[model samples]
Target: MDRVLSADEIRWIHDFLELKDITYYDVQVEIVDHLASLIEAKWAAGSRQSFEVLFFEVFKDFGDHQWRQLLGAKQKGVWRQVVRNGVSIFLNFFTWPLVAYTFLSFLLIYTFLLAVPNAVNYLQESMYLWGFIVLVTWGYVIYRRPAKRAFLAYDGFVTFLGIDLYLVGWILPDFFAIFSERFSATPNGMLGLAAFYSLLVLVILTFSILMRIKGVQQFYKTYPQLLITQ
Candidate 1:
């Protein structure tokens, strides 16, 4: 029979990882599995060393600088997943039945601009409001589910949302203002610009909502215990 780590030994591994500051469950889990495999392999090879000795022997492969490099690499990978998920979610709005709703939303905004004299001002205000909402949503997530922060995926998603806050709240509005100004001299131009901005804001807000909800749900589904405790 192959020697496997006992439950206590695995718990010890978790503790060691936390002590080493690899506390994110999403990242720690992979390292734990790899370390477990290496330790078991040593035991199977007829090494008489204790678990601590075997662990240090294997960990020595990752010197302090190497460990930091590994951590940075893992973080970059997690953030890349965040970007991929965001792109996928953004693309879904343009496909199938969702595309119908998307067009309807654009048309409705266009019509609304045509009907209201001050709709452009309202639209700008709404963009700022949505920016505030994004910040609040991000803050709520941090406050309500601090445990989720222990996940690299969740952390990456939250950071992505923060970047989005700056883009939607500041960059988008400035761009919309400049774009509207350039086209205001043409017929139906302001209305068209406002409508486009509105649709864009809608799409971005939807993307942010879906990203946060999906990310949180997936993490909880995978590790329900995190929810039960914190």
Candidate 2:
């Protein structure tokens, strides 16, 4: 029979990971599982080496610099997954059953833009509101995120939020004056364009907020031990 690691032995693996600076909680989960499997395999093979010895022996097989390289690669892969997930979720809003929400949002924005005295200014204000929503959503995520335990996916998603802020808060506001002057003579045109842009901003902001919430739920679900009251 293959002997499984004792609770203390399992904890030793965790401590080893931390000692190696693999601090991201989610990343540690994968490496810990892999290390456990390797250690158990040696036991099954009739190796009587102690747990600590087997741990290092297995780690040693990865070559002197290979373990760090492997960790770096995994961290990069996690960030890529984060971007792919956000894009997929954002695209879903424009498809199938969710498309109705997208349509209605556009209609409502167009209606409001038509009634407003200054469509451009209204659109700018709408962008600011969406930007604020993004910030508040980010704040909630930060509040709920475990202080001592970090997740690569969660950190990657927050980085996306920072880019969203740059676009909505800084980039859009700067070019608004130029665009507004060009469309000044065409209020109808301005209203349609503003409405479309507003809807786009709204959808992007919604994506950021949803990504943060879902990311938190997922990490917590997978690692309940890391759960903390917000």
Candidate 3:
């Protein structure tokens, strides 16, 4: 029987991947397991190769790109997952009991803006307020959260979620100000497609944050190390 890899050896593999910038925990873990299995198999084949020798051989199999392909694969997968999760969240609001509340919320927003003497002015200001609020709240959450498992959030989905929110919050008002000034007079230019897309992005970011928080339980079930019990 071949000798199994030690804990330190596994961590070495992780560090190697990290050095290659494969920092996402999910991607790192997957690749580590794969390399371990290959290394052990090589060892069992009576090859007198050291860990470094075999590690290089395995890594080289993925071409000169190192871990970039794997990293890209994980990023792409996470993006797809984020999109799917967003769609599900979007649909949930328009279905069954929540639909009524969603409608009421829409109506309230519509009424509040329509009732204002200068609706566009209020909107421009409100976008800034909303952006500021989003930036502070999410920036605080990300700043305070322990980083031991930050890699777990590195799947790119949650990271991008927070990033998009922070950016949207910081930039939306400026965007609205510019767009409303230049294009508001045009027949179809109430809010450009860009602003409309930004609205959908905000919705995705909001739901993505919620998913990541609620997702902690699911992840913790699989990776108990994620839970920082104090």
Candidate order (lDDT): 1, 2, 3
Q: Could you say which candidate leads in lDDT?
A: 1
Give the candidates in order of TM-score, highest first.
1, 2, 3
Q: Write the per-residue lDDT of candidate 1 for residues 1-230, one digit (tens) a residue.
A: 87888988887987888898888876777787888999999989998888889888898876667766778998898778778877888788678777777677778777767787766677777777787778777777676455443777667765674656776768888977787667754547866775677567776777787787666665556666644642
Candidate 2 — which pairs collide? none
Model 2 misplacement above 4 A: 1-4, 43-48, 96-114, 157-161, 221-230
- Model 3 — TM-score against the truth? 0.66
Poorly placed runs, candidate 3 (over 4 Å): 96-98, 106-123, 144-146, 149-155, 160-230
- How well is each residue in 1-230 modelled by candidate 2, as lDDT tens digits? 67998888877777787888877767777777888899999899899999889988888876647667767897688678777877788777678666677677677766766776766576766666877777787788779777776677567655664766776778766666566667645757666565556565666667667877777776666567544411
**lDDT score, candidate 1:** 0.74
Off by over 4 Å in 1: 1-12, 143-149, 181-186, 223-230
User: TM-scores of all models?
Assistant: 0.76, 0.75, 0.66
The candidate 3 region of ten consecutive residues with least summed lDDT is 193-202
| Local distance difference test, candidate 2 | 0.71
